[model samples]
Target: MSEALASLLTALADDELILGHRHSEWTGFAPHIEEDVAFSSIAQDEIGHAAALYSLLAQRSGGDADGLALGRDAAAYRHAVLCERPNRDWAYTLARHWVYDTADAIRLEALHDTADEDLRALVTKMSREERYHLIHADAWIERVAAGPVEGRMKLEDGLKEAFEEALGLFEPIEHEEKAVHEGYLPLPSSELARRFRELAANKLDELGVQTEIYSRSDEAAEFVASSSGDLIASGDEHAESQPERARGLGGRSGHHSDEFQDLWDVMTSTYRNNPGATW
Candidate 1:
């Protein structure tokens, strides 16, 4: 019922929905049959995860899951820019998936100690599925990197292109501090971002890929590290200051692209005409 909890739920659910939609776009057009089947399954998994998160949010906020998912305006959705962006090429999807899923693994890990017992249990189950998601992403990443020059080049280009969007995955909203204070989340968004970068870098290194150096703002990094440390060490209300340097395309701030608006219209076409419509 708190702003922090709502933001977390909405953002997580939105990311899943958007990524699922993107993956679903490839259902009939994958590079091959096996990939098509695998991507379809992953798409289903992402949408199912979104449903689960939405259900938990509904329980906490006394809202209907269908309405929460199908009724939101484009500007109200809180997914990362990476998830909402078009799958420009297969390399882009692979890069985005690897980056997003790795960050997601870290994000979910930070929620293991959620104060809500039901949510904590849900996180446990969700983590199981997330592991496979990470595995799938990593496998493709490795395959492409270790394959032909064109494959490696494509993956590299995609990774560089999506780096900024990937950073958006951990952009903190105003109530993130409250979430940490209340034990709804164990780690602040800042720490999660650091862990994401580190983990992604490690994976790329293992695959023999040279990563582009991401520039960091000294002031922003200091504030995040300092504030994050204090919040973890002591439970208290902190300022609403967010990691602006990490913001990409303003997804977490409720701004979206035309691509997302189009996505929303298509996703909600049936429901818009009839709220009682069922899939």
Candidate 2:
């Protein structure tokens, strides 16, 4: 596998893993029985996707799939901050679902035509599952944003709080330009980011929610700061730097937030305790 392919796969796998955990955290806590069952299924699919991706990535990483997935410290995980963030409320979780599904849809679309045959096949398989995930997200976003006043307030607050960290989901991979040039990715990361912003903003607008979108000129420069690592967003990146961004960064660069460490420890504790044990 190309180095770029490996790096991209690692980041993608971590995103799924952490987001799966977050979704699963709501398994019993979802607002209603129907939602509880629905979200639990979604959580299962996400975790399965992560495991499958990790298995493929292990071939290039030269490690056991389980070990690769289980042994990583919080700082070593390449998930976006949005995924690792502790869930605050149902609206917040739903907002994250909206942001993540939008980005993941584009990411998978870009990878569908990858130069690597194996990756292309895996992405193709994942795409079918993600279609349903997108539907789920769309339904929830409409429900929350178009619901009661409290629901509207929560959705608005959630978007404002999460909008910046969600940008972290599109953090550039090393040699990302090379990948696009070489036909590994469908388009430039900037284009995908633009699509995400437009979709999110348009959705919010349809619901009568006011959202400030980034100007076309602010695209590349705002998303990736030179001083920060390719995967890390600088602390200075906020709504002022662009539009709807936040100050926190560091997930794509593998430097997770402080809250992530506890979540990581809990998630890995069972596997760590019995590395060789099997179900």
**Superposition error at 20 for model 1 (Å):** 0.9
Off by over 4 Å in 1: 213-247
Q: lDDT tens string, model 2, 1-279?
A: 777777777888888988898999999889999999999998888888888888888877788777767887767788878898888988788878877888899889888888878889999999998999999989887877678888888887887667756667776766677777777776777777778777777777787776543332133324653643343233445534444333434566676777788898898899998867985
- How do the predictions measure up, each by TM-score? 0.87, 0.88
| Regions more than 4 Å wrong, model 2 | 213-221, 225-248
lDDT of each: 0.77, 0.76
How big is the positional error of residue 161 in model 1, measured in Å on the Cα after superposition? Answer: 1.6
Question: Which residue pairs come into collision in candidate 1?
Answer: none
lDDT of 1 by residue, 14-65 (tens): 9999999998999999987998999898889889889989998999888777
